[model samples]
Target: MSTGHTSVPEVLDALKDVTYPAGKEQLISAARQAGAGDEVVKALRGMPAEQYAGRAEVARSVRVDPDSDPGTDAGRRAGQARRGGKPGLSQHLREEPRTPIQEEFDR
Candidate 1:
């Protein structure tokens, strides 16, 4: 599992033999037994002490190095630009006109 950095696939490979609904300790131990490196172990150690249902759950729960995740690369980020994000969360509220309309009854 030592490929310089820890990725989801690498983490999953290390935990392949682990039982489902395993806790943090169980994961760490299994990774170590599978010859995982410090980075992988560290990532697993940082995970919350909860039962994991399966590989998918563990993959989602584990935090991998940003550099290792291609989805967050500079190219992807540029492509996903939000045009400086939304105008604001409450932009619609400010769109209402302040001046009241003159109705026949009011007149």
Candidate 2:
């Protein structure tokens, strides 16, 4: 990782071989094994200690554009544009919608 901010593609590349729903330790280990530098590793360490289901999930956790590819410079620019310059993490953990039966019980 460079001294600058870590890119979403870079993080994803570091976790290419990581299993789904990976824990914090698993993610850090995978990133290290993939040759991630201190910046990238620090970013991973700062992420919420929870299981990530996929790259998209990790992207969201790190406040990157989940839809854009970070592999190329152009892609990184596109992702940044898609992000609209917003910084910090958004609400990733959401409550599941209740079924009709559950709603009725609440009522």
- Tens-digit per-residue lDDT, 1-107, candidate 2: 24366766788888999989898789999999999977778778767778777888787776333234334355454555554433334322222345799999999
Give the Cα-based TM-score of candidate 2 against the true structure.
0.56
- C-alpha RMSD between model 2 and the true structure: 10.8
* Local accuracy by lDDT, each model: 0.69, 0.68
Candidate 2 yields a Cα-based lDDT of: 0.68
At residue 82, candidate 2 shows an lDDT of 57
Clashes of each: 0, 0
Error of 1 at 53 (Å): 0.6
- Candidate with the greatest TM-score versus the true structure: 1
What does candidate 1's lDDT look like per residue over 1-107, in tens digits?
Answer: 46566777989999999989898899999999999989889878867677788888787768676555443565544543433333321111112222355444476
Clashes of 1: 0
Model 1 regions more than 4 Å off: 1-4, 67-107
